[model samples]
Target: MEGDFIKINEWLKPLSWLYGCIIGFRNFLFDVGVLKSRAFDIPVISVGNITVGGTGKTPHVEYLIRLLKDRFNVAVLSRGYKRRTKGYIVADANTIMTDIGDEPFQMKQKFPKVTVAVDAKRVHGIETLMDSDKKIDVILLDDAFQHRYVKPGINILLVDYHRLIIYDKLLPAGRLREPLSGKNRADIVIITKCPDALRPMEFRVVTKAMDLFPYQDLFFTKLAYDDLKHLYNGSTRELNSIGSDEHVLLLTGIASPRQLREDLKPYVKNLTPLRFPDHHEFNDDDVQLINETFANMPSPKIVITTEKDAVRINDTKGLSKEIKDNIYSLPVKIKFLLEQEEVFNEKIISYVRKNSRNSILAKTKDDDKSKDSHNSGNGSRTISF
Candidate 1:
């Protein structure tokens, strides 16, 4: 089956090549300044992936939020993929999952005080966010790796450890949205979902294989799944509460759940996965199927899902009372491996501090807000606020 899958994708290599050429040309236009890329006065840090599907982008974004929210006025801007409405909209008390997309809404719910907004045009999003009276110290561009209209101060790229870009092919033939060369644009490259027990020799081997530029910094992180929380009531309980004889129905909508599945296995007697597509919306059929699946399981069975999926499920109507009472969300976060979290955090904080409108750089300049240096010919500018 694996060989057959490979053969099928190999046959589609021609299409991938055509797609790559178009993407490469677009990138070239941006590089040459024919297509304008704007820079904001305040610090803008983008976190994204060149590959399609889940590389744990949300967890990593949350990690940065946790690191910076205490010291800075942080805001998040996302494109709100597959949202119901159009144009830029800031998440507020009345915002639903469909209004700002699942990930942004999830963040807003998790961090009530943080600002979260969605706009297809990231440049407009950043500008509007800047115009706000609350004074955003920094903005995080979620999943904006491909949206080059705004040149972020720090470009953080995430790669799935299980699906290394070195071994993968371009889109249609593989998961990559662009050529492996696209990895060069990343200021910081992180390998997500890494094994906790990875050896030093294995680490050295991967570092060599990546062949990153001298200026690029590399880091590794693994998913750290937290204790179970009630899907409706927002109450917490330990995973160890599930007895050894109890069953767990691991339901997922994200692209990759292998690591989560593995980590959950030892906690329960039998682990049964009811998988769905990435960001899948639950309908009547799905609801029925889930109820049926859980019914067939033995007694003392409960359902578990990732926090991302839990938000979508939270608003879904017509769920059975029993199912609602039993389902729980497993929160996950990223932790830097090899004791390098402090190093990564310092780099981020340093960049934000240096470029903030209220930073020492701005205070020393003695300007009203910023001293942006605009390039005359290209229409692009570097902001040293």
Candidate 2:
């Protein structure tokens, strides 16, 4: 559950074959159409991973939103993982995490211009989007590679640079939800969270092990942080800018906090890490602990959490108000390697545009052909495309 043990489990080695068999059968069924994947009339691109968690899919989804927002009418559809609501719930300014799920809420907060909706049944969610306000030209499906019920136009699969699928076994033993063979479904494969000091040999080894499709595009990206900011009031402050006189408390609820801790090591004057599970919903009790900890930590203490954690903690009320007031969140964005940002950006944009345009043309041509057939049969009038 921690450290190198995360890499492999001795007891799970035997179960790998069984996991592989189940996954293989599932893929085969889908491939043969014995299991149907429903493709919508609208453009849907899925951003997901083969491995279970912590590949930085959230940032990738955000990257897509930023890349496509200007040119297209975009919307996000997710399962709303731990949400309380059932059926379809679209995230507006009024939508709460309890109602629409935390990730969608976070998406709503970050990209208010775009629509965010969630349904355990993705087809229903897509239907809601199709029937809602705002002209949604495209839909981005978050964490949806496994959700084959509603197929996407483009599948962008992410694999962590350090945790290649080839080196990993299936679940129970390893992190993969499916086998490395499942890479066949991805149109774009990204190796995320790469070190800044990547060399040619390392890149070569990764790319080789990736064993991608002939047409699949591969890219590398890393998590780069911005200045940490206050959680409650949204005031900006640099990580290293923390004065030597300032004592700080770090709070995080994510799959990985080691990276975050290391990032603030040089900058923060004094540090205290309050770790929680990934996507942890902080209650009053947790906030109380933070409050007490900060109160006892001398006079000038600053409380900090990651951006995702900040969003969750922001809603906590009661005695946590003063503690929350001092709570600041550090923001980080995905920075791609190879200076190919524009190239990758254009590739995705161009694909969506090209396919969407093609679909429109095809539909128009079909409509015209149908009209012509009707006219010819009735001996009435002509129709043209």
Highest TM-score scorer: 1
Question: 147-168, model 1: which lDDT tens digit per residue?
Answer: 8889999999999999999999
TM-scores, each model vs. reference: 0.93, 0.86
Candidate 1 lDDT score relative to the true structure: 0.89
User: How does residue 65 of candidate 1 score in lDDT?
Assistant: 94
Inter-residue clash pairs, candidate 2: 231-328
Stretches of candidate 2 exceeding 4 Å from the true structure = 1-8, 244-246, 296-300, 318-322, 357-385
RMSD, one per candidate, in order:
5.9, 4.4
Tens digits of per-residue lDDT for model 2, 1-385: 5755855576677788788898899888988999888987778999999887678888899999999899888889988877887888877777777887767888888999998888888888888888774367789999998887878888998987767788887888878898888888898999988877799899898888788879999999988888877765667877767888888888888876665676677787688787889989777787678778878887687888777776677676654555766767777889889897988988888767765644576668877877887877975544433
Evaluate all candidate structures by whole-model CA lDDT and list the values in order.
0.89, 0.81
Candidate 1 error regions (>4 Å): 360-362, 365-385
Predicted model with the maximum lDDT: 1
* Candidate 1 lDDT for residue 168: 92
